[model samples]
Target: MLIGAEAVDTAVELNAYLARFGYGQGLSIQQLWAEMDRVWAEMGLDNRRPLGSQRIADFYAHPVWVLNGLFADTDPTSVRHRQAIAAFLKDACDDQARLRIADYGGGSGALARQIVDRLPGRSQIDLIEPFPSDFFRRRLGYRSEIRFHDVLSSDGYDVVIAQDVLEHVEQPIALAQRCIDATRQGGLVLFANCFYPCIQCHLPGTFYLRHTFRYVLASPALSYVGAVPGAAHVLIFRKHGEIDVAALVRRDRIARGVGPLLNLLGQFHSQMKTLGRRAGLSE
Candidate 1:
């Protein structure tokens, strides 16, 4: 549904509106909105009630999980968020692949709900969420399909996704391994959780990175935060345990294209930060 002239204009206005906090800087809002209008109308999208720069940009950019944990003060599924996600997924995963995806531990299936509108029509995406939203479940999987499970096992899936679900488990690595056990070989487990460095000790229970512009300004790292060092996104490939994600990232080169060249260097900063924490914790 997100195609042609309307989407282009909506995307442009969104990019410009999101840029005010500094990160979305210098993007041509007027030109972009003009380009994306057809996209906006086709998608039945509108930006209702303007939001703060940080919240507008953050929720628009990050996965819904990170947006929830980090910006607890704001609504996770804001209109701006919807528009941004629609625009972004169009660029990233607009392929004609029939994906048997699992939204493992997804609450209310909002992620799955949004995907229905954004992805190409009849993509055969199955969203498995143990806790499906009564409201959202009804809406999800119309164009696609969303299967709700009170409990779920990952078997019989092409791509298993657990966004911020891993941190809550005591044995996160074990949980990740279990997710791997569920995924069909060559299927992916898409994880987009927060990263807490080694220097930052675990405070008990589950905690995730709640990075803000102020937080980024104060800290020294510059990458999408992963799980804490002792805790990271533990993915098990069909054959191998780890995917060469960095090289994979290089293949896409989006980080390289977006900002300063040096900004790309910090993607691995969390790994190093974890090592540093391990040294100190061991000492």
Candidate 2:
């Protein structure tokens, strides 16, 4: 059984390094725990438990679908996504700590566990979620060396996994920097999400997914609609050293009306897979 973390313990555990990371105030363990309790009940979720001291949060739904989701969608079942995530973690792991991973905001640990299970070799995984209800669940196994942190104040990791957590943040660059800092000088920070820094769509403004709970410092709400992706988790990627920004650009130019058409094509392919399944053919 995992030895559950309480509010006070969370404060004591993270107090030493909290100041170093510029995490700001209103992060007392007790405060976060209470916030978790209130938020879950408000969402109408039945299960309740003390939030662990680490900065972990709720079980995420985005990456779950990518890794385990059975839904019919584009890249819904990612053999490539899992393979890519494992490759990223392996590339960032250091010899000093057997792959010191800082999974910030990895609430359910499903992705972390998935990566761990796929890797096969021994490695340590550290989860950082800041909700009380997250800590009390029986599924969160306890290990002396492997554990969770309410917040990430200390640095020195081979890989910092922040899948689907950036768009939700109030300060995207600062958030990216935090992950970069936790990473060793040459380590990597990998993340992803539905929103990008730019908007290719004709819509007047960009949008973000709505959180049922009012987040502590996440970006202030700017919309009334559901997320375009509709998944609870957004993924992020970080690297300790400078990233080659040039690679992101595509050499090919789109025709006048190709963007939406390209998107439609992606959807068409997704439906094709569903059609195949109905035909009793494996995708």
Candidate 3:
């Protein structure tokens, strides 16, 4: 029943965890955030360029991802996003119980907990995080309903969620396919990606999806279901079957061919929005 401020305070939890186990005993949460950034730089992860797949995997597998999730998952905006997704699920799966849900790269299991509270089901949540935080593991250890997985099966999930995951990968297309493949036919799949150059971890290579998400819409295996109403970033779809890989590849090729112009336009729009905010004309 906890919501808003009464919900888990990830900052406080992270601070305490760092003080107890990490090399951050005397540091504030802000300092820890900065230290994480510094460590990333020292590890050569913040090169601000497109990293290869192996490098991206190695970066994510490092223990720093634990800190990164703790720092990133509980802002006001992220809290509201979890609430919206929970509400959406409550309505979307009202008639169903015993749901099998998969959360792809779900970091700290906050959203999974929210969904469990709202859904009137004995659902099993498979948290597909390769590098799950120790905090998350210990906190949810007693909750058998929420299972952890380094990798997941290719199918049988009633719902598959990949919030804020696609942009961090080197091969987003392959990742997207896995998400789609993981869902059973007629099952739901939700994706929220920030394919912009917003942070060091969000790979620049994945920005191709910034303006080319229509390619996903055109897939034969999936039917576009609707955007999460309050959280426009989260899009829902239903998988029909396996994708027509050849057709999808051809469409993707065409999309990539036009990606440069689309990227330029997207950058121009962002610049204008920034300018408007600076001029006190927009928020």
- Strongest candidate by lDDT: 3
lDDT tens string, model 1, 1-283?
5566975775566446444323323323343333234333443433332223223233223222222322222333333443453344444444636556666666555556556666645334455544344334544445346677655575556656666565434334455445555666545455544433221111122232222211211211112223322223332223233334344334234322433333334556777899999999998
Q: lDDT tens digits, residues 1-283, model 2?
A: 5644785575454444334323323233344334434444554443222223322234322122122121111233333454456655554453434677787766556556666765655567787765423332234565333567878765688767676565545444456556666777555556555443231111111122122111211221111122213232333333435323232122111221343454556669989988988889543
Tens digit per residue, CA lDDT, model 3, 1-283: 5446633575566566555534333334466556656556766774356565236566665555565555445556667888899899878887786789999988678888888887745678999997666667887887777889999788589999999888877677778888888889989999998887555676776676787875645776788888998899999999998888778777667776777689999789989998988989544
TM-score of each: 0.40, 0.44, 0.80
The numbered model that scores best in TM-score is: 3
**Residue 152 of model 1, lDDT score:** 56
Supply candidate 3's per-residue lDDT for 141: 89
